[model samples]
Target: MYLWIITGVVLIVSFIFNKDKTIQGLKKAWKQLYGIGSLLVLVLICVAIALNFINEDLITQTLSGGNRYIGFLSAVVIGSIAMMPGFIAFPLAGILRQNNVPFMVVSAFTTTLMMVGILTFPFEKKYLGFKVALIRNFICFTICIVVALVTGLIYREIF
Candidate 1:
């Protein structure tokens, strides 16, 4: 609601200032919107299917009985290896939570999924400098570990 109102205000302002430029910009945006929307829809469908295929029961059982350290380790290892989309990762985390997976582990896993993309390392190194990519990943990995530990401690204290 707020966004629409703001957009309307912008459009009105733009029209008052420069109708021709605004019209041209809108035309270009419309041309690109369809392709972008279709790509997003395709990705969403793929992620939904992947989430459905993951074994919720197994995820729950494994997490419910695991030690804190083990869970943290698993998060790091799994996060490093798992190459799923964010949409799929969140659903997997939800399943793990329902199964009694520790909050710290889930936090770590989620962090690693977003922060440490080992699967994209080659492309990252090629586009950005290898050293820059490695350093960034190392920092992110360290932060994930710290976040997991801090979150685990906080949860332990609270509950």
Candidate 2:
């Protein structure tokens, strides 16, 4: 993916140079990319802070004894409803794993966290078109379920 992205950048730069708009195009791309990077960093920081305040042991105890299927369902439901930052999710997942939460459940939850932002629905609809947003969310949710099932089967087979 990184190789493809770099190749795409090189191609775009060459095209811009050929068109004699290299400097302007580069500037525009840089600004847009930098803004996105900044936003991602900010989100990460917020997530980290939230995770730091939560009780890791308590979360682990809560999730560790649950059935794998139940955990997966809970993750999907919570991910859809909860609007917590990704940083918190990561640490929470780590704690859950330590206490024996199924890998499939964690994977599904993480996927849903980024893919199905219930809290952002209105904003997404306004900015990206309702149909587009709905379709994307549906696809993401379906894929998360499929992935969880496959991962659960694989884990069962391996261990």
Candidate 3:
């Protein structure tokens, strides 16, 4: 709320100072937003559908129960596949923690959710080329696991 207020005030000030530039900037911003809007909506819808099938109990059982490695692997796979915005992912992480899901699993999910983009691979590939996109995704996936393990260690969720 505060951020929005601040942004609105800043935008108003910019408009006052240079109406033409402000209008031009806003037009470009809108174009970019419009370009990505459909894809963003599609991604959010996919995440919503996925969430409908996943309950808090299932998350706790799969992520915090026996076989930590397997649980971590499951989180990596699911998170890598599901591409959601950070705004949604962070709150979801909180919910997972509230459900008693271990920090390691939550980290794995959130890290991979932010880093890996399996669902957006084609879009990335189009701009970055197939090889670069694939390599980036692979590195991000590895880093997310490392980050999750480090977080687990810090939180003493792992011995």
Best by TM-score: 3
Candidate 1 vs candidate 2: the TM-score winner is 1
- Off by more than 4 A, model 2: 1-62, 157-159
lDDT accuracy of residue 148 in candidate 2: 75
Put down candidate 2 lDDT per residue, 25-133, tens digits, no spaces.
7689898777567556665665566446434554455456657766777778766644566787798888777777888877777778778876566555755789999
Residue lDDT tens for model 3, 48-98: 787676644555567766677788888888788776667777887787777
Candidate 1 — which residues are off by over 4 angstroms?
A: 1-65, 157-159
Q: What TM-score would each prediction reach against the true structure?
A: 0.60, 0.58, 0.70
lDDT of 2 at 65: 60
Model 3: residues >4 Å from true position, as ranges?
Answer: 82-106, 119-131, 149-159
Q: Write the per-residue lDDT of candidate 1 for residues 1-159, one digit (tens) a residue.
A: 999999999999999999999999899988777646655566566556654643455445555664867767767865764457678779988988877777898888888878887766765675568999999989999998888889888989224
Clash totals for all candidate models: 0, 0, 0
Predicted structure with the largest lDDT when compared to the true one:
3
